[model samples]
Target: MTETSTEGTGTIEALSLVPKAEARQSMKDFKSDQEVRWCPGCGDYAVLAAVQGFMPELGLAKENIVFVSGIGCSSRFPYYMNTYGMHSIHGRAPAIATGLASSRRDLSVWVVTGDGDALSIGGNHLIHALRRNVNLKILLFNNRIYGLTKGQYSPPRRSARSPSRRRWARWTRPSTRCRSPSARRRRSWRGRWTPTASI
Candidate 1:
């Protein structure tokens, strides 16, 4: 479904980009035996459901997909999926995923990171991964607040009260906007809304 031009050669080779699955997949197929442990009514449940429901349409083999996540409450994502995955270090999922994608050309690499994990300490790592143009599906869940630490605000969270501050606190970084004109030009990016009770 794609083409790659050989260096120093004028001919372009067509590549069947995504590997066709040997069998049709189902939501149950992707559901791991591990218990679902996120906070009740957390938006992650919806994200998990949507992903599981849609995986079948991709016609991909479960074993061929991998999910990598960093340290955070959301980083526990790998545990809920049946496919192979890694629960990696803090703010290092993208860096790790890039290497995985590079070495395993036949596997589909996905990164699941939260606002703080991807935009704060992992900012540089995330930026470079995007620059590399590697085949990685980055899923950034911007819940607006730091859910795992439970004491501070995340990068995308606007100025607001925080647990650590106990009063109105300004954001450490400028509020993140969806308008990434530069990033949008090079790749596909989309957003969705998920209602949550609390973090």
Candidate 2:
């Protein structure tokens, strides 16, 4: 939450104030009671495991961290983590995370979105968040297909556009196309991209 104040000089000020967690935390402490409901070999499971393992290293109280996700197979992430989170509308997780991070600076905000959700419907929100440099982390799951909607072609699908048949192939000569922008950002803004295997 935020509050605005006006001083004698007629200057307005917006303050970000959120209470910090007072208790120490562990990996088990961040596990929720809900069951993991993804498919047998879905990439979301691997991402979830990696996130769960990394959260404990943040050393923040469980209540101070928030994971916001959009509608997709990856959107079910909040249910698996025992923290403040919201499974929001399709392609709007970045917008929601923006508000939380802007108003509650004390909280650690994270966004979990898929290729279709982030690049198609939520592209505007994602770009604005990155442009503004919000204090949040956005994890874009690029599985190339809509896993939640049962194998629909996504925006990032590297397949030939033939009506008769569709097949997966490498879009660019090198797979480093995705990392180029992130690499540039790292050089200028100190943002690091943690590349995971096939997730």
Give the root-mean-square deviation of each candidate in angstroms: 5.5, 7.6
- Listed per model in order, the count of residue pairs whose N, CA or C atoms clash below 3 Å is 0, 0
* lDDT of candidate 1 at residue 194, scale 0 to 100: 61
lDDT at position 186, candidate 1: 39
Q: Where does model 2 exceed 4 Å of error?
A: 1-24, 161-164, 167-199
Q: Give Cα distance to truth, residue 194, candidate 1, Å.
A: 2.9
The CA lDDT at 127 in model 2 is: 71
Under the 3 Å rule for N, CA and C atoms, how many clashes does model 1 have? 0
Model 2, C-alpha of 17: deviation from truth (Å): 9.4
For candidate 1, the lDDT comes to: 0.74
In terms of TM-score, the best-performing candidate is 1
Which number leads on lDDT?
Answer: 1
Query: How much RMSD separates candidate 2 from the native structure?
Result: 7.6
